[model samples]
Target: MTDNLNEFNKGELIIENKRDKRLDNALLTTYEGDTLLSCVYIEHNSLPELSIDDVDTTTTFFGKQVPFPLMINAMTGGTEQGVEINEALYNISKELGIPMEVGAQDVLMEDMDTAELFLGEIVEEVNRPTVLLSNLHANSSVADIKVAMDTINADGIALHLNPGQEIFTKDGISNFVGRYESIEKAAKEYGDKLIVKEVGFGMSEEVIKKLVDVGVKNIDVSGSGGTNFVEIENLRNFDYDFSELYEWGVPTAKSIINARNISKDITIIASGGIKTSLDIARALILGADMVGISGEVLKYLIHGGYDYAKDYLQELMYKTKIVMLLLGCKNIEQLKKTPYKLTGKLKEII
Candidate 1:
């Protein structure tokens, strides 16, 4: 049965067709009723009053200077349709002058031809000085990590932790038990390049400390309140009884706060459920070095096409500028040190 499921998972049907449906369902389920970041409140009263024009949005990551502290998070690859999506995303990223990350490179690691055909095309198309990020699952070995990174000429690799997805998916790979040592080993071996990331489920202060102890300098809080991978996997299964739990995990704002409280040295990339420039501003204020956009970008591209996505990105930039001006922030650094008030669940969690 597992073999059959593996075959079912391998074909183009899984990613090409099912992927869209999964994404749609995940978005609907995650953001259907209320806003996740609603719990966070910006205190304009007690905080220093500033204008949006004063905000400086420039930021640096991994020694690369980014015009804005925003990255298009790893979205899709390894399938034929994924190539088109990647091209569209890369084009937007290039136009916006922000860094971008490719989807998981597991397929590339297994098949060099696929890497050249898909990932290589993406790199070539986005011929700008964008920060290219490669990806691998946490369970991947040191060799797998190296291959995944080298496959795409990644500026850095995002080692993702998705135990919930692995467990929830039908025919999912079990025994995702030995990631700590593997992460440590990968960090030691590729400390120069890899950026460890969490998928949906947020990382805690304790987890951040452990990763720091293991020599990780970069961490992406791909926290919850965005694309619910468990929900996506559950949609794929259709038989899961715990579908409601898809709404589980950390909100992007809270995750940023936790990350900031734990380690000031590690680069924090806020993701999971990020939509607007206000969300980006909130993340930066909460202590994220950069913010990641995925599901929203994909939705824009699917419904409104590439031009629409570009417009959306431009609007986001405008919103970011407005936020910075209002905060009187001259740059991304100032935004980070800027004061923000937390309320609701976020205040409790923080």
Candidate 2:
């Protein structure tokens, strides 16, 4: 609300509607593909001397231990609905002691005032989430990263790769030539603090290997089985037909394996279509250091409001612990090493 409603900046108007459109599309769309997490089944332990009370979900994010490995992930910011979503996700992250990576900070560079509105009263240090990550695009400059982090007081910055969305969206970047070089430079300056992420289409072995070779440590595959930006952009305009690309991208489970195969030092964040406790456990078992849920969480928040969102995540945590107990794992480390077998299409791919 920095500008007058009557005379809104035309550029901001487009972004505002785009943000609203994403949420609107998300509210109506249900993913039709599989994340292939079902292929990863944690072998149940009949006797481990571990009770339900002994199960622990704690894991490290940005070098800080949290109650669980699940993160809310980047969704939106800079608009009215964007503000609400950030605040709700922020509160949930704070209460649950998890990370919350906000959507791209492109707006913060233009208008710093929106940063205050984006995160709400939590702009103050003591009130923010335990781990807050600012987001930017893959082709962003180091200066952009610094400015975005400064504007939002973020602990780190995530440089996201979304070539598919960029190619299809109106006025989106078509030439993605220097993204890797830019990311390499950012990784050098930020070290492990920089996260190179894929925007839902998932990451391939080649891309994962390239990122690892460039000194990037933190990675969010953001694999398929969740939200589809191409579909969202296509839905935004019914005149065009993008139905053929709906089933594109790598599944979340397979994406994690791709990263894991690249290097053990690489920190993997499994996301995209993470809905159930089984999904959470499967992600961990598949080599994800942490799990992220965005589309599903947004769906809950939109339909049930803040209270419902909180309750839904709480129940998810409970169910995740139950999965750990069944697997005879007492903590995250145990769960990571838990036995799993691959079946179906996923089994053939990896």
Candidate 3:
């Protein structure tokens, strides 16, 4: 594997591939479908009184105190358009005092110079003590990830496991052999800085245990009910119809519970199809320490622009606080203990 920029040009193509596919999906498909988060309702407190001004939304993760638990999930970066999108997202993250993860930096491992010149420059411009997270493919080794981390001074690295997405997408990495081995090696080297995540499909309790065994302490259960990569890839490949697998993978709420059942010590990052403040509140109630929003944030940036995105995020944080006050919960820890009933399909799944 030559580390030439030309060789890595193919990897850059994949970034474009994902970006185009997602845009098309957002335009053509329906995002109105429920994330199933509506099933978990927070118990409303009528008699209880809590000052809305006193509601604290801040939470700690990766040894940093983030103003909010919301994370701008990895979106784009490789080309000129990607840099523009990253710029908007970076600015929004900085303004909101929340964490943001860059899209997979596998491009950097292949072509360091180009990635650094583009994405790295955006990170440098957004430079701060914020909890910026880096990302890469699950099969990436420790050395490959080190380059990604160094590119942005990442507080943590997310290795996204997307066998389902790859299996369908044209030119996708079909061979995920030795991926777990790579994860083990990276975990050994990075310790708690390593985050094993799913693309859209959620992880099972069994898989969570395996990752825990490999010394993984942070897990982002990027479950289904959000962006269906299989459906997106099928949309990319016009000839094939993979719609049968559209509702595949565990829902985000269920996935969080599954991971919680497996380990209480590990940090659980709930993501995938997170659309509203209620969704964020529900995830926290179900044991998620942090929540990641990709499609929602990117959609705002693409459709409404930077200022719109910032205002939307600010409103979301406000709603999250309102939910807390309504539940008589002052902080994230208290919110976790807030009583709630799980009903409908979610109950069956749980």
Overall lDDT per candidate, in order of appearance? 0.74, 0.83, 0.81
Worst 10 residues of 2 by lDDT: 1-10
Q: Candidate 3 — worst ten consecutive residues by lDDT sum?
A: 1-10
Give per-model TM-scores. 0.87, 0.92, 0.91
Model 3 TM-score is 0.91
- Cα lDDT tens digits, model 1, 1-350, are 11222222233333346545554465455434222566656654336366555566777876788888888888777765566666667767777788888888888666777875445455543434778888888878888877776666778888888887788878888787789998999889878577889877878788888988999888898888877777677766866666667677777777777788887777888888788877887887788888888888877776666777778888888887877766666677777777667787677766
**Model 1 residue 70 lDDT score:** 82
Candidate 3 residue-wise lDDT, 1-350, digit = tens: 11222322233433444544555465455533455788996778996577998888888988889988998888766655566666667767877889888887777766766565335455554447578888899988788888888888788899999998888787777887898999999999999898999988899999999999999999999998987788778777766787877878888988899999999999999998998989999999999999999888766666555667788889999999998998898888899998888999998878
What tens-digit string does per-residue lDDT give for candidate 2 at 1-350?
12222222122333355547776776666557789999885677777788888887887788677888989899888777677678777877887788899988788778878877567656656535488999988888899899888776888899999997877776668898999999999999999889999888999999999998989999999998888887887777666688788889999989999999999988899998899999999999999998999988877776656667778899999999988888888999988998789998899998
Better of 1 and 2 by lDDT: 2
By TM-score, the best candidate is 2
Task: Give lDDT: candidate 1, residue 316.
Answer: 89
Identify the candidate with maximal lDDT: 2
Question: At residue 11, what lDDT does model 2 achieve?
Answer: 20
RMSD (Cα, Å) of candidate 3? 5.8
TM-score of 1: 0.87
